[model samples]
Target: MPADLCPADAALAARLPQGVLRDPAPAYLEEPRGRWLGQAGLIAAPRDTAECAAIIRACAEARVPVVPRGGGTGLVGGQVMSQGPAPLVLSLERMTAIRSIHPDEGVMIAESGVTLHAAREAAARVGRQFPLSLASQGSAQIGGVLATNAGGVNVLRYGNARALCLGIEAVLPSGEVMHDLKRLRKDNTGYDLRDLLIGAEGTLGIITAASLVLAPVPAETGVALLVVDGPEAALTLLSLAQARMAGGVTAFEMIAGQGLRFLAEAFPEMRQPFPAPPDWSVLIEVGLPDGLSAQAALEGLFAAGVEAGLASDGVIAQSGREAAELWALREHIPLANRHVGAIANHDISLPLSEIARFIADAGAMIAAEGDMRINCFGHLGDGNLHYNFFPAPGRTREDYDQYRKPMTRRIHEMVVARGGSFSAEHGVGRLKAADLAEWGDPARLAAMRAIKAALDPVGIMNPGVILA
Candidate 1:
């Protein structure tokens, strides 16, 4: 077992300019899902990269475990160490700074603690767009975003967090700073250490700052909500939109009727675009150049979809305000889901062709187990789905707690059988370490273990994460 932070570490705490908090508050111990309540003897917020390095060095020397924390907005238990020795929680909250912005070069260097919303606004100030967006953008920090390689709605066009990051400045397990914050578009280095560390979930190293890629603001943008027949029809509509709009399709999200119903039940004030939610519908956004009209493109796609019988009805946003309102609905679905409570929540991805089949099969499999409510929705453009299970009407999640484990296992097995990932954007954290071990290829698992041993031999960096 790893050693806990004790009074002997007072000298190291004194060296940190930002100081340490001995009492781990509810904010530091609890995760968003409330699945894990962590225990920590010390909570240190470093003001700078050097201070972060010193704290890590002290932990390494003392052979004490250190859990790197960000905004604590992670759905998984990555930010919290649940069942381990009381460790030092190193938070990057104090290091929130925009180091530099190069609008001409389309890049920005920001400290890890900078929230995604701040980064987006910074890019907007320079007339550039950071493109990466999520429901948690208001609280999710750059470090945690890149660490888990998050994928959100815009991932259909902008790619994940790993793609947005060009380089990172990180502190290794031994307290050595790996300063490779280059804005270069092309770097032919021996090994891509930046890529390795980005999705490592702080198990390899803790990212302090990053150089991120930005995009030119779209000249025209529009959002459309289209009613589809089912997952198959949604897929057809996606292909049609891609064929018609090409690179203009910025986001293609699918929402099941149950999700819309839940939104209505939980948040009655929020306007529903459709009078009655279709069994399956899609929210598509298009970003076009100056000459091309996004509204026209969406109308064209809608007309084609209707003619092809892929879509039954649709509505397009008439203004920027309308577009944001439409996005607000999409973003608030998760909140509605939380209010309803979930028995099992899954974030999985499948090959584009297998999505419809997997959804159909998984629904059937879950139905066989029990009469549960399933909300199947997500970024259909990129083949990632939030396949969540909830209690039946007039029921509570606790009433079905006994089935959570078996239902999750069934879902994961079906996903893996269909060549889908058990954990899509959510990192392995403490929750999915066993799933990773079971589904991960033996060769890849071995290589990951070796890399962890090489970079964090003492396992001081976020212990019990990614690896067992």
Candidate 2:
């Protein structure tokens, strides 16, 4: 590394490959705020692990803040550059290459820039499945998913991104490359350092590559929509369905009647999953092993729900296309709400038993606030819910924006009081840093800060992200 890599230089005439330096004023923003402003700085697109380490080393020596960005699809401002003499953005978008896939070992290694879609496609080509499916998979890079420790709809059984990962390759703040990409199932090491980097949001280190765990592709899938009286009944149906579906229960989501209505209005072609509208409905998916049928499992679960009166109405998808269509309804609700100008959205999780109580209580509280339309629905099987509030019937976006913080604060407090987490899937990026400071346990906060300080002593990598 050289000492001339200062933040002031437009382009430092370096001895490295010309592909590493990028000279352009790219667009940057702090989302959750969605403020897009001009970001003038040099960018680096390192080709390999050594180049990545060199870039970090140069940035650290120069005392320049380095923000590791991947796909820029993160909900929080984790990828944003809001401060510091136009920080250098080290993007891994160019290092996308599937290194190898070992079906027998059930592991695959790929560079950070590889999209989730590409990774899964590679796995599929090899007759394996990378089951971490998220909405942004089309554009989201594997590095971003691993850095944020993202969880998606299928997390009911497959677990989150961290659970699906076996090994990680990251560039430490001191410019040392940690190549811990071993395919071991169990390693009783001194500490789980890979887990530390998993959800650090690029604050600790830059994840350049990862070795991920793969599952056998499901031979068959059964999809169904069950309408129940309310969230409590939804939970009952989930309990019964889980008992029968076991590992096959891939997704167990809850949709409120109002959310379904919005989806219908927004997407006219989408068929409602239920015959009659109920206050709440659950979308359950069962994936069987090779040569096994999920139909039997789904049918038995439905019968039990109907007989017990936990489910009032339901429909089992007759075909694969129908099942995909039903899932589209659930997945596209967020898009529909975005189109309707949703000013505030909370991705939260509560205890399974307390979901009903939280929904009822939160709905009443939000309703009391003048003219707010709430869209509260999501993964009921695991207690995660996307509780969104649109601007009061006819208010401007600005009006809604002003009240977002207060509304979110109250709602988050209620969620905390109910023995639930304020953030379930979406991480504590710049948006929730303050809330984290306030609500996070003091001992835990201190420990996290200690780790952050030790990892990046100069506070360079994604400063002001998850920790102070």
Off-target runs (Cα >4 Å) in candidate 1 are 1-6, 9-23
User: Can you give the lDDT of residue 400 in candidate 2?
Assistant: 62
lDDT, candidate 1, 377-441, per-residue tens: 99999999999999999899999989999889988998899899988998889899999998899
For candidate 2, the per-residue lDDT at 449 reads 93
TM-score: model 2 vs. ground truth:
0.94
RMSD of each: 2.3, 2.7
lDDT (C-alpha) at residue 34 in model 2: 62
Q: Against the true structure, whose TM-score is highest? A: 1
TM-score of 1: 0.97
Encode model 2's per-residue lDDT on 79-124: one tens digit a residue.
8867566777788888998999999888999999999999999999
lDDT of 1 at 439: 85
